[model samples]
Target: MIRSSRLLNILLVSVLLPLAGLSQAAGWPRQVVTDNGTITLKSAPKRIVSTSVTLTGSLLAIDAPVIASGAGVPNSRFTDSQGFFSQWGAVAKQKHVQRLYIGEANAEMVAAQAPDLIVVSATGHDSALRLVNQLSSIAPVIVVNYDDKSWQQVVTLLGQATGHEDQAQTIIYQFDQRVTALKPALKLPPQPVSAFVWNGGGKEVNLWTADSAQGKLLQQLGFTLAPTPTQLATSHSMGQRKDIIQLSGEKMSEGLSGKSWLMFVADEDTVNQVNSDRFLQQTPAVKQGHVYPLGNDNFRLDYYSATHTLAILEKRFVH
Candidate 1:
């Protein structure tokens, strides 16, 4: 009786294993609806190439099989010599991610990588939309619009495309846990803060709106973004971007009317610059000594940079 029972259990295990594999297989050759259109992948991508430098960090965070990527301006405040963002450049180097190009998207270099998937941003300076026709011939191409989406949303989208949904879910859960724990420990600077990237000695400024990832993250941590004045709502001097409102010249003081100011992609030097600028010395934030530098890598929020941002904030506000 014991021998017969053992045989039955072994047969049952053999039958169930293949069914489990089949269940997971059924979802493949998946159809992902993107900004460009519908793209179908016959299998999970093994060699992925990201043309958008901003999107590369999220792809790496999820452990996607990114073999190569395009890069941005190199050796700047936020990037390395290869033009990879400071937050994820090390990871890219570790993974042996080849540089497809620096400032422009190159189809030939991308083709040499022999990627099974290619990701392009729908908007931004890093967009490869113009090269879509050429890249599509090399592999299945998907266009993602990161400007209007949060980093988590960007991860979720890339997760689906790269067949790493489990990794995507895990990272977001971890980030949410950190946010929850940090929320209670904070002593916020002030209510209704103004967040922006200030440059050119107060000549160029881009204000973050509630629609941006940085704005969303600040709001998640109990900070409020001051509303853009109605008269300034239509200002699009920097192009039609949903993430920021560009202001310059006489409009600088009118738009920067927050109780406190948080500068993104900045450090202590930037804060000093804001303080010393004669034109900006009278600004409410500068006058009250409420201006703070979030960090140099705070411009593009991804899992790596976002994590760094949380650390910076906790140290700044969590006395």
Candidate 2:
């Protein structure tokens, strides 16, 4: 009887040992170092908070659920108004997105949500970093440098941090396939000198060079960049503020005589004002209907923006 009991115990141990190993394999380590900083994760974080709209969008794209999102549009209803997050369902159905709009994030509010991890974009605001530092006191904070990282890199890093690398890679592969399929369909005009205009309080226009993502997109579509006074002057950053000769209506018409124009406006009033301006009306692009208005509000150089920008370009310019 004793020998029989020992045999049964041995069998139970043999069966349970492999199950323990499997459980350990499934549960990844709690801490990971990202490009921005070292994140100390506590267990597999089920609840996550994202500060940037791009990060939020990227997470959703990878099938990762975010408990809270900071910036984008006010409500899910208005998200589609810009056509960026239009198909992301409702705010209520978006897992645990607390209806919180913080142009600048509040650390106290983040703490209140009690997220297992916090993700933020490194951009125009330094407040996000401060919030991350503060939140780190309560939980792990992972800062993603959105400006420098490519879309694939961002998605991969986020997947690694969230333990969803395979899932993220699958989504990225699908998106790449779609982009590849759509590239051949675009017919770009040869030597088409395109000018990108960004309208704000002041009627500002920016000339995209080879380095700019928008410029690269245009290049892929076979459009050439228009040479402006700044382009003629000393070479500077793609989107840098430079001292360029702002031509009046008469001069602008003559200056942009031969080239096609691609204009981007924030609001309808600004678009109307630019259209009504005599100088802008004289430009070749305006006369020839080459003006391309970027209607999406989520226009940035980040991963999400790049993909959406490509889709918009394909739809409007390609077709």
Error of 2 at 141 (Å): 1.0
Measured with C-alpha atoms, the lDDT of residue 204 in candidate 2 is 42
Residues 182-245, candidate 2: write the lDDT tens digits.
7788665435665444434334444444544455555555566666554343433233323123
Residue 292 shift from truth in candidate 1, angstroms: 0.7
Worst window of 10 by summed lDDT in candidate 1: 17-26
Question: TM-score of predicted model 2?
Answer: 0.67
Clashing pairs in 1: none
lDDT by residue for model 1 over 168-198, one digit each (tens)?
Answer: 7778877877999999999988778999998
| Best of the candidates, TM-score | 1
Score every model by TM-score. 0.90, 0.67
Off by over 4 Å in 2: 1-27, 30-35, 40-42, 72-93, 125-127, 190-197, 205-258, 261-273, 301-311
